[model samples]
Target: MALKLRLKPCERVVINGCVVQNENRRYTLTISNFAQIIRGSDILQEEDAVTPVRRAYFLIQSMLLDPTIAANGSGAAAEMMAQLYTTFTRPDIQDRIARAMGHIGERDYYKALSALRPVMEYEGTLLSPAPSASAPSFQTEGLDLHAGHHAGG
Candidate 1:
């Protein structure tokens, strides 16, 4: 007697306006201005309210796990490196990944450590990914809270 196995087709992922299609759904592509969506999907199994700190932690972890990020020679040691780079360089994204990091660190050391490992590894490289033609331009002319809110969000 003989047995047969079956397989299903893979779904394509559209991220940061780039569509990466592959038969294997193992790899993740990290792009600017869209990490949140990817991270949220990857980290959250079900939809529910999550604190920014928790979201930030999960987001950084997801980025670190991405093959693209790991291939850049930035290993597990630099999980939150992606977020730190974005915070200082862009400083305009609606997400407060940096502030969330601080809050998590203040309240939970383990969570903070998990988030900071990446940042510590590539301190020098802690600059945001440069704006590409594909990226949207900054909107905040002023640095006030209201202005920052508009630009950041």
Candidate 2:
């Protein structure tokens, strides 16, 4: 099946490890064969990869964007993935990461990226502090509650 892509003006896409930017106008493209493709929005910047899972994601992104890295057999991506596997013990996250690894091994970078999305989101939840149970809820009982209502009433 062919993939149909409709790109906005000036939008960029990485196809087969090459960065291609759209012209000043919107354009549509149809890809008929097997190729690596990533939209600009989905690309992860290096500085944005602050956590272990993010780092792993960045590595995977790098592999997909750069053919040399993917061809040279760099173990860095695998090493980082292994570290993440050890750090995250949740069965669901582990499964996603493992599936991503399988996709990587199969050279299916897009599928690997899809599998890693939930793992990254789960990592974010784990790293973020949970809302405090004792936090006070906002109440409109006391101050100026009638003042605003009177103007509209």
Top model by TM-score, which number?
Answer: 2
Instruction: Give the worst 10-residue stretch by lDDT in candidate 2.
Output: 144-153
Local accuracy by lDDT, each model: 0.39, 0.86
For model 1, the stretches where C-alpha displacement exceeds 4 angstroms are 1-43, 46-56, 59-88, 108-153
Query: TM-score for each prediction?
Result: 0.21, 0.76
What is the alpha-carbon lDDT for the whole of candidate 1? Answer: 0.39
Question: What is candidate 2's TM-score against the reference?
Answer: 0.76
| Per-residue lDDT over 11-78 for candidate 2, one digit per residue giving the tens place of the 0 to 100 score | 99999878899999989999999899999988889999999888878878888888887876437777
lDDT of 1 by residue, 70-136 (tens): 2442333234434444545444321334543453434332344344434333433443366578887
10 residues in a row with least lDDT, candidate 1 = 33-42
Where does model 2 exceed 4 Å of error?
23-27, 133-153
Q: Which candidate is the best by lDDT?
A: 2
